[model samples]
Target: MVSVRRVLSILFCLLMAGLVSSLAVGYFSADGIQWIDAVRIVLLAASTGWLAWGAAYAFNGLLSLPLKREDKTFELVPTSARTAVLVPVYNEDPVKTFSHVAAMIGSLHALGVAGRFDFAILSDTRDPEVAEKEERWFQRLQLECGAHTDIFYRRREQNTGKKAGNVADFIRTSGALYEYMIVLDADSLMEGATMAEMVRRMDDDPRLGLLQTLPKIVHARSFFGRAMQFSTGYYSPIYTRGLAALQGTAGPFWGHNAIVRTRAFAQSCGLPELSGRPPFGGHILSHDYVEAALLTRNGWTVRVDPDLTGSYEEGPDNVVDFAKRDRRWCQGNLQHGRVMVAPGLKPWSRFVFVQNIMAYVASPLWALFIIASIAAPTLKGVPDYFPEPGLSAVFPRVEQGLALTLLVGVFGLLIGPKLLIVARGAISGVNETFGGTGRALLNTLTEILSTSLLAPIMLMYQCRAVLEVFFGMDGGWPATDREAGSVSLSEAWSASWWISATGLVTLGLAFQFAPEYVGWLLLVAGPQVFAPILIHVSSRSALGTAEAGLFETADDRNPSPVVLRQEAILAHWRGAEASAPAFRPVPEPAFEAADAER
Candidate 1:
């Protein structure tokens, strides 16, 4: 039985697509239905459909309140079931990574439940220098936390399956040692209270196999990074609330900041590498989503509790790094076409797979729409009005009003929800926490404007990535450069030179062949023309904090104890750099709600 919420969502998408696509038909085929017109309409429907899909989530988030926070009256005892806190690292910074792990240990110890949990540093660090550093940090982390018995460290010489494989190996060797496992990224940190609450939730539900947290982005230091951090703090909670509403029993597992029952995961999530070599085959890149589906497939409930706070992770500080991360995800998502059809999966699970694919597919779909729209004017040939003698020549009914309505409809879909969220915040005094209503509104506008500009540039990156995957170009798993500095002009141009060239050529062709859409073409292709500049400017850390704290969130204003503790550890380590050991790539690893945008 389809739930009412699901039905409403589906109907909304259908009606929105039908209304706009019909207007497109009326406007493009006023003279006669041509093949080009049909192509334009289809593309418009698909691309707009994806836009509306996001809008639907946004609207739901606006209408709904944040998920109610749970009361933690009950406490875990020393005799409670044991859980392992797993931090998987692959060729990542050792001091920074261990700092987070050490902080989590301290946090748990503060609650006096440290005995109930074990900490494991699962490393697949391939670089010997980095691995040696990782081992040194593990020793330091153990010494710092004084969890000689509970804290453990192990490194796999063969990181065959990446993060997923690393965790699987842990489970296989120590599956019987613990009842539950809290999987975390190298950058993940959570408060003691939050971990206790998550354990409580799992204890309350016998059928629950996985519990996901909405991790806030921290330590972002650039324009792009700060924007993401702000969105994660201000907008993500609402979006996550909406997701929680729709997720039901099958929710997201974002590869980290999640807890899973060890035995259940070991039984259900022995991921088989796809039969092919890379990209479409071999180890899955987006293993989290598939693991969630698999858990649900075997009757284990997978859920995300938005109200769970104190979870945190890091993000790419620059556009180029972000695009590089997306390339791998794009391949992983495209590979989901194979898993979406697996036996006995829930309908919603299948839909979720398709939805994830569209996260990247929408880029190329919109690109195709623009190209087809530009070509449509010329392909229509000549329209005939005076078929017989003395008949009045008609200027092909343009339906200018209908066209205007469609244009407004599309733009509304893009920005309308942001406006509503702002309006709602203004009414609810939520703006007070965000540095007053004025700044909230201004910041929202700035975010929308900036993301809109970046969208076109990112769309080109995704389009190329999609083409590469489809044509059998396997984007091998690459480590994330979590420590990238400001991107120089030369570097930005090197990365986006082809993007600029594509934009210029596109605009030139659109103006020359189809002058009618020159304005539209500029909006679509103009940003790409300035991709290098935008990328470089946004990559600088100084500019992000110079706007009088415009993008600052409450978290930035007063960080949680866990975040503050991590920073303290980091600072202390930096001071002891001369005394510390050094280290060194595992393929380190959203939106349109894409990976929760945070």
Candidate 2:
């Protein structure tokens, strides 16, 4: 009699034990492989590496389970200790940035705890025009929000650390003045009540050096826009919660949308520039994991409060915009390779580094795996050897089953968390965030389909970004200014040909030889392969006008310079037609008056 439950349990134990053994063997075995085997070896090693990450994600999800309670309430009151709100900006629209900052300052002032909080606008802008505009904007902002906030602005003469260096500079200079610093991106906004609550959580738990809040995705409007908005709303919280749970005292740190203890950050978070050039040189692209690891090494706890709400951020408008952002992130995550082996690092920190690296490396490895699988069927001489663990009758079955199980682990990590979060939301009746269960299900299905297409597209982009970074191309944190309206077919094809070509070749090979498996590979990666051609062209018309709704949020709320400039150009044309010049520009104030005002 096959006892179904007992058999399942035993199989599960064996599967897990095999996975551990494989990973342990792979990690140690990695050193023995030569150059030609690097790709093959890395793929095999990563199978084990990725499983460990999946386990961590699963463990993180478990730890964050308590935070899912519907009735829970956070302590919202302010403590006596001071807090610093660090707003980090690159070359972003300073006017919009100041507006959001002003709103939060007003909210804090209304709460009567404004004096206890301080705000610093940490600028890394180097462009002369942009820097000048930011300086003027800061002056106006200070006059407006200064009554309730101790507002200050700092720009580095040398933008050494990019975002990380900008932040480290802040800690070195003004860190001693505050107990806690809430890090905010230029695009980020946080509610005062929630800000106070984060501070309270830190005050209550002396061991806590970091507490990250879940940020609501905002300012999306296009079809592509909606996809992003829906995905972030549906997935980020649970994923973050899972991470928080697994990390406990050793959680990962995102550079923004979180709070850090000033003293802990000052002591532990000074990022040492990696000894290399370009993508791996002068600075680590992703600094959060390194900082978190440093913090953990010093006995400070890092955590993510998924239940913490009212924090908000914006997403990229469309596929092209997303790719632009990913380019920088790819370089940043790839930089973690050097940090993983650094001296005196904590156990969890190493895990964090591996997780960061996998985000980019996995896509390429999967691409290579697909190539290998296809070639495996046709090539008579190709290696298909399976290791025999000494049980004769079950050896082949065990080997094949183990291989299948190992591969399934990748999908489990990627897809399992989404399914679990969806289930949790359904059980807890928190499905309203996705506009109810019906919408959530529909969106999830749509996302799976679209993401399949995006996978190949992203694979190529990440590959390009990684290669670019590797070959000494600098993807600095440049703010995106997405053009509204449609992109041309030529443009899309040019941008996406490599991915599309790869996809076409894969499809051709799969159809020709491996009929059984090629369809599955194409189904998962087909859309992504042609993403540049299909998505970019399809999204172009939608981009330029009201259809390309990237800046609809800013447009709806504030007048756009684009609009204003267009109107000005037209007015000048109309005046010239009427044989009269357009209204004269406002005369500059005398030097004496400008000096007096200053």
* Tens-digit lDDT string for candidate 2 (1-598): 1134224433543565456446433432322323333444456555545654554454455445454446344455747888888888888977667666766675566557788889999888878898998887677678666878799898888888788888888888888888999998987777666788888889889999988787766655455665665666667666666555455577767778899998988888887776766667777777887888888889998888877776777776566667878887887788888888888887658867876888887766766757765664454233324435564432111233444565576556556656666677677665654455665666576666566556667677777777676777764332433465344556666566666777777788888876656646766557856666666643543234333332232223332222222233334333543564433321223212322321
| TM-score (all chains, Cα) for each model | 0.92, 0.76
Candidate 1 residue-pair clash tally: 5
Error of 1 at 143 (Å): 1.4
lDDT per residue as tens, model 1, 221-334: 888988898889888877776787788899899999999988779889999988877768888889999999999999999998877888899998889899988998999899
Q: lDDT of each model, Cα atoms only?
A: 0.82, 0.65
Candidate 2 at 564: error in angstroms?
A: 24
Model 2 lDDT, residue 46, Cα:
59
lDDT of 2 at 177: 83
The number of the candidate with the highest lDDT is: 1
Sequence-dependent TM-score of model 1: 0.92
